[model samples]
Target: MATFTPTKPRTIGHVDHGKTTLTAATTKVLAAEGNAKAIAFDEIDKAPEEKERGITISRSHVELPIVSGSGLYALQGTNEELGEKAILKLMDADPVRQLYRPFVMPIEDIFYIQGRGTVATGHVEQGTIKVGEEVEILGLTQGEPLKTTVTGVEMFKKLVDRGEAGCKVGLLLPGLKHGDVQRGMVIAKHGTLKTYKKFEAQIVYVLSKFYLRTADITEKVQLPDDVKMVMPGDNVTATFELTLPYPLDHGQIFSLREGDRTVAAGVVSKVLS
Candidate 1:
C-alpha cells in the first residue's frame, strides 16, 4: 500500500462541468496504465436526476493510489461509511421513520452544493448556535443563505437541533424579506469578511466558446458591481476589475463570467490593476 499526505482538502466539484465524465476518464486511464486493480472508490448516488443526466450529483469518493512499494496495500477515499450498500440498506429499512433523523454522519467546515430545498429537522453534527452569536448567510449572490444565532431556533421532535454540512437547511423566517434572491447563492456567518474586488485569481478553464484574452467579452462576472476590464494570460490565471461597492476577500471562489454565462471558476489571488 502507499501512504500520502494532502496539502489541501479534496472535495468534489459540482456537475455540469463534466465532473462525472472527468471521473470516469481519469479512473479508466489510471486502471489501464496501472498493473493492479487500483484501489476502489465510492461514488455517491445522491440524485436520480444525476443518474439520468449522467452527471455526478452527490459527493463521491475515489482512491488515488500512490506509487510506493511494489505491492501496494493501503486504500484511501473520501468517505467509507456512505457506500452504496450501506445507503441501500438504510433506504430499504424504514425511510419514513428515519427521515426525521440527523445525518448518520457529520460534516463540519466543509462546502456543499444544495441539490434541493427541503424542511430542516434534527440534532446537527455540531450543536446549534444561541441567539447571540452572529452568522452570515451567503449564496444570495453565489453562496449559501446562512441564518446564524438562535433568535428563531425551535425544537422539533422530527427535526434536528442543527444541520449537517452536506444537507440543505431550510429556514422559516416569518417577516424576512429578500426580493429576487434565487438559488445558487451561499450563506454563512457575517464578520470581518475579506474583500478583493479588483484582483488577480487562479482559474481552470472548463468551457470556452472561443479562447479569451484581456477585455474579451464575458458574462461570467456576477458581482453586484461593474467590471472595468478583464485580462487573461498566465495558465489558469486572470486579472479582474470590479466596479461594485462591496468588498472582495482573499481566498474567495467565484464563477467567472464572459457575458451571460460562467467561463471559469477561480480563487482570488491579489488585487491588480
Candidate 2:
C-alpha cells in the first residue's frame, strides 16, 4: 500500500525545441530503468492531413505519465498536443498555502477525451493519490459506492502519476461517460468520505437586500431556489437540501448561488447523514 504525492513537471521551452520529444524521451528512460510504468500523453494537433497528417502538439504542454510509487517524471514524450496549461483549466489559488491534510477532491467539471475517457478536474482539498489506485465517488449514488480506478493524473499539461493535497489536477477515469458524473461530487478513497442530501447549516442571507415582491415573480421569471425571499440578518440557521447527494462534513463552508450570483453563504452546522 503505497501513497503517491505526485508532482507536475512542465517543460518550459520554445516551439519546435523538441518539448514533446523531451517528454517522450523521459518516458522511455524511466521505462528502461523499470522505475515507473510510463504513459505517453498525446493531445491532437491539427495540420492539413495532406501536410503532416497527425502532428501532435508542438507548442502547448501535455501530460505523460509513468505509474508507480512516486510516479514517474517521464513525460517530456511522444506525439501529443494540449493547451499550454495542458490538462484542464489551471486555477492557481492558495499559492502560499501548503495545507494538505484531508483527502477530498470535489468535482468542479468533467471533460471527455476522444481516446482517454472521462477526466474529472478539481483542486486537491486534502490527501494524495496515484494512478492505478481505486477511488470512490462520494455523494453520487445512494449507499452504492461509485468506485473507479485512477487510470491517469495530469496537472498543468504534464503527466502526473500521482497527486498531492493542494494541486489542481485532472483525474482520468477510463470507460466513464461524461453524463455518469457531474459537478459538485467528491472523489476520495473508498470508505473515507460520506455523502448527504439534507443538512443543517448557519447561513448569512445576502439576497434579502433584493427582496423581490410577489409581483416580480409573477411578472417576470423565477429566481434560483437558493434565492428565496429572506430578510437581511446576521446569521440564520437553515436546513439545506441538495438536488443531488453531495459529500459534506461539519464546519464546511459553501456558497449558495442563484444562477451565477451569490445569494448566501453557509457553514455546516450538523450533517444529517
Candidate 3:
C-alpha cells in the first residue's frame, strides 16, 4: 500500500507587502545560479497615480516560477517564452466574487475595507470570503483599502467555525443583521478582534481636499466608522484615532497619508482618550 499526501495549492499573498520585490530577487537568483526559470508579469496602465498612491484599485492575477516541474508559461504583457521549473500564481481576487454573478440580488451598498484586518457582516457584496484569505477593498484609487486575513468565522447562531479557503461561506454574527455590518469592520471570529484607539502611522496625500497639517485632527469616512483625523505632514508620522471599534493588533498595518502621498505606516497603541 502507498501512503497519501496532499499537494498544497500554489498561492501568494497581496503584492503590496514587498512581494513583488522578493519575487524579482528570487527570479534573479534562480536565473543566475541556473537552478530554475522565472516568469514575470509587467502590465502597465494609466494608474501610476493610483499605484504610487499605494492603492491597487483593480484586481489582477500574476504567475511566476517556483519549484515544481516544467511547462509553457503565460506572461502578462508580451508573448515571450521562458524555460520552466515550477509555476507561481499571483492572484488578487476579493472574497466578494462569489456573491456576485451576471445578475443577482443587487447589493445596496458596495462596502470597502482596507487590507489584513477583519470585516463583520452577514452578507458579503458578491462572493464568499475564504477563511484565512485576504479580501481587497475596492473603491478609491488611493490603494486597496487593506489586506486582511480571515482568522476565524461563524455562521448564524451556530458556528461553522472552520472551513477551507475559496469555499462559499454562509455566516451569522449574533444580534447583528446584514444591514448592521459597516464596511470597515473586518470580519473574523467574534470577540477575537482587538479594536484600536490610537496609533502613529505614515501617510501620503492623494486627491485629498486639503493639505494635512501636523496635529490637526481630521476624519475619514468608511462604512460603519470614521477614521479620526490627524494632521500629518507629507508622508510624516503622526497620531490617529478611530471613530468606531476596529479589529486591530500591534504591528497590524492600515493605509493612511498626509496629502498627494499615499502609504502611511502606523503601529497600534492604547485606546483614545
- lDDT of each prediction vs. the true structure? 0.37, 0.60, 0.36
Worst 10 residues of 2 by lDDT: 211-220
For 1-273, candidate 2 gives per-residue lDDT tens digits of 233343354544555545455455455555666754545534323455513644444343433342221112224322223322232112232244334555668787889999878899987877877889888876555556578999988876667667776677899988777677767567887788776767777777744211110001111122346756666565667665555556677888766546657676767788875
In terms of lDDT, which candidate is stronger, 1 or 2? Answer: 2
Residue-by-residue lDDT tens digits, candidate 1, 1-273? 122222322335545554443334334334554622433223534477865766655563322322212111112222324322232232134212233422221111222224422222222322233323454433214333344442332222223344333333333222224342223222333553332235666776533321121112222332223533443532355556544212345575566465678676677776543
Provide the clashing-pair count of each candidate structure.
51, 19, 40
lDDT of 3 by residue, 223-257 (tens): 11343443434444445654433434445444545
Go through the candidates in order and give the C-alpha RMSD of each one to the true structure.
15.6, 13.3, 16.0
- The C-alpha TM-scores of every prediction are 0.34, 0.55, 0.34
* Candidate topping lDDT: 2
Best by TM-score: 2
Where model 1 places Cα greater than 4 Å from the true spot, the runs are: 1-133, 137-158, 178-186, 192-196, 204-236, 243-249, 257-262, 271-273
